[model samples]
Target: MKKSKWSAYLAVIMASAISCFWAFWGSMENFHEGWHYPTLKENLTVMAIQYLSFMLIFILFSVIAILLPKIGSILYFLIGVAFSYWIFSTRSAITLSVVLSWLPLTLPLLLIALLFWFGEFKNRKLALFIAIGFPLLICCTISIKMGVRVSRRFHDGNYEERIVKGNNDVTLVWASQGPGWPKESIDWAEAQRRCIYLKENGKELADTPQNIWRLPNIKEVTSSLTRNGQNCQGVWNPEAREANYSFPPDKESPLWDIYSPIIYFWTSEEKDKDNAYIVVYHGGVFSKPKKMRGSVGFRAVKSVKNR
Candidate 1:
């Protein structure tokens, strides 16, 4: 009704228009690799979900606040949890609702909810951006956050490479792409390539020069394997696969019982010809000997920063 309310609504309209175009353009660009893939079904699915979530919470709250404003806030809060849970059900969509990511997302919704009751006029534009942009951006921003070299899609479908940095320098590091040999012994060439990759791409202020080396000695390798947190344990799906953040066909989805989450990262340094240092953390901490690579997974690391 008020001028500000109209402005807010206008912003939502614009953001929706822009985001729709953005998603469309993106889908078209990938039409080749996904030539036979579903056309707009998935796109419509995500967009519909996003829009309904925003409208049900913010727009409905505005309508209900005509009488009971506080009750509307409670409803608004529930919308977020519902939205987040829907995301978590699919591992590919988990990033949207995970605790580390959910904080930033929920804050704006909370503010929008409060504003519905507190602001003199409606500003649907802010709500629109929050609704449309938040989900879309969540898929982009984290990949190149801060100053870390956070991507490594080595050997095509072979693996997904990454390095995330922190203020204190090295945080958590591992690789999840290598020969997963269960019946056979681990491959040595793959081990050497992993180390070489790091040496070629390491730095200090910008990348971890020294921190990126392969565990040259067994003592160093074992020490590295047995560390603080345990994300390096468990069996790994050995097929050469790339990291995917979007929906895909049934055959393409990695949700199969056989598909292994990149849980273990092996050091190139070999203790003996048949054995090398491998971080077998699928759950919490890296443990003892894990000779077989079939039931395990591998990824090489390269530190160009303290990341």
Candidate 2:
């Protein structure tokens, strides 16, 4: 009976440790990369905050498991089940490989819970091996790959340009690029905030004025397009209008050339009570609400209003 009780305690400890490690590792890695331009002090502050937050959660989990072993094991099992659903729900297109990859992140917690609940049944060693081994392997492999990719982008000069001065009549300033894949993309409101930041900060050039720039209207956004080489079409909806870049890009539009990959931008035009027009540089165009979030970007336009 002593051995049995000890197994339950050990299982609980292992489960908490592995779960905390996975959570901390994933959160820190994404946090490090998302705000890529943070100074050393800012980065350290963020890390400290994240560490404290996760550590508190970890302590709570440990206490629960220590005080109520059976209930804690059940809770851990439920968490694992919920996480399985979460992994699939987050996928843009679910497939076998995606499901398989996500399993490593959650399976260990489930296995540890099972061990605690059943008191070390047959094949427990195999279960333990799987619980511990898979996450470590996957986490290390992913970390190395992420480090390499970030380093390559740093050296390749692929960082998005912050400000691009257009013709003297109007100036175009770049907005948020967002946190890349597997995260909520910059929405229309956030994009607008980026523009406001630039305008107030002189577009990082030390001389630009503030409050003159604003989110461009549908007409103004369309007017900036230069159909230099390819056919362009004006796509209109009841609430808004957009110019499609078609299959070939407009070599003339400087904005299009820079953000050629995913040049979707939000316009100030409103579509009904909620939706607004979004201009796409490559994948045609459509409208969505200001609250709707996606990978859309924006360019703040500034000019003297006609008298």
Candidate 3:
């Protein structure tokens, strides 16, 4: 009876350790803000959610330890392995994904497996030590590696040169296309406000008159074609072109590649008091109601006086 009780206690301890690890892993960002009480107070909902998740994980592990050690161990182990495999399989960079995603997914499962094994092992104390010690070593190792990689990327000058500006009045931010694209989609009012905010914050366009940094009309948005070359200024409205008709770029619309990330941008042209036009550089143009939202991005343009 004493031996069984010792085994159960050890299992609970191991499960507790795993649950704690999961809690910290999931809530590290929220917990980071807790260093400032005001920030924690401001993020009360997030903090509450983090705390709730931790408690739920703790309860789940504790129950599994007590009632269904063997089955629970296998279940969690398989879950962890499957999750880790899925992450590694889908990732382009396996080593980075293993450090950043796989271990977090599987570490809890490993702990659960060890917890169940504790009851079955003749040397329960040894099993307990191994379960706790091994995961700690892995956690420390990955944490150090991830920190170093992130810090290196931040310090590297390569990250600074993301934006590519054209000879035209318009310029594309580095997130102009492909991955790392901006995910903001705002209404005309909000879009105009954001442009104003950017301008006021000294992100003004060069060689343009003051107050010229505002949202472009449909015509102005289409003016930055690669075909326009050095003369890509103002809006370029196609003659009687269908709203959805997207044509291949000649010199007239060479901007299709330069602004590839521009899936949709809010144009200053208002369809009504509530609806507005959105320009899709490659996909064609469409009208969006004030209420409808999308993953559209915008670029600020300024007109230049001819030399």
How well does each candidate superpose onto the true structure, as a TM-score? 0.27, 0.39, 0.33
Best by TM-score: 2
Q: How close is candidate 2 to the true structure, as a TM-score?
A: 0.39
Off by over 4 Å in 3: 1-7, 25-28, 31-45, 50-55, 92-108, 117-307
lDDT of 2 at 156: 22
lDDT of 2 by residue, 62-140 (tens): 4465555567678778878998888888889989899788888788768766656655334444544444444446445
Ranking by lDDT: 2, 3, 1
lDDT of 1 by residue, 138-215 (tens): 324432241122111111232333442322134334343332211123444554543444433332122233335453
Name the better of 1 and 2 by lDDT.
2
Candidate topping lDDT: 2
The C-alpha RMSD in Å for every predicted model, in order, reads: 17.2, 11.8, 15.3
TM-score of model 1 relative to the true fold? Answer: 0.27
Error of 1 at 51 (Å): 18
Candidate 1 segments whose C-alpha is farther than 4 A from its true place? 1-72, 79-113, 141-152, 156-260, 266-307
TM-score of 3: 0.33
Estimate every model's Cα lDDT from 0 to 1. Answer: 0.37, 0.51, 0.48
The local distance difference test score of model 2 is 0.51
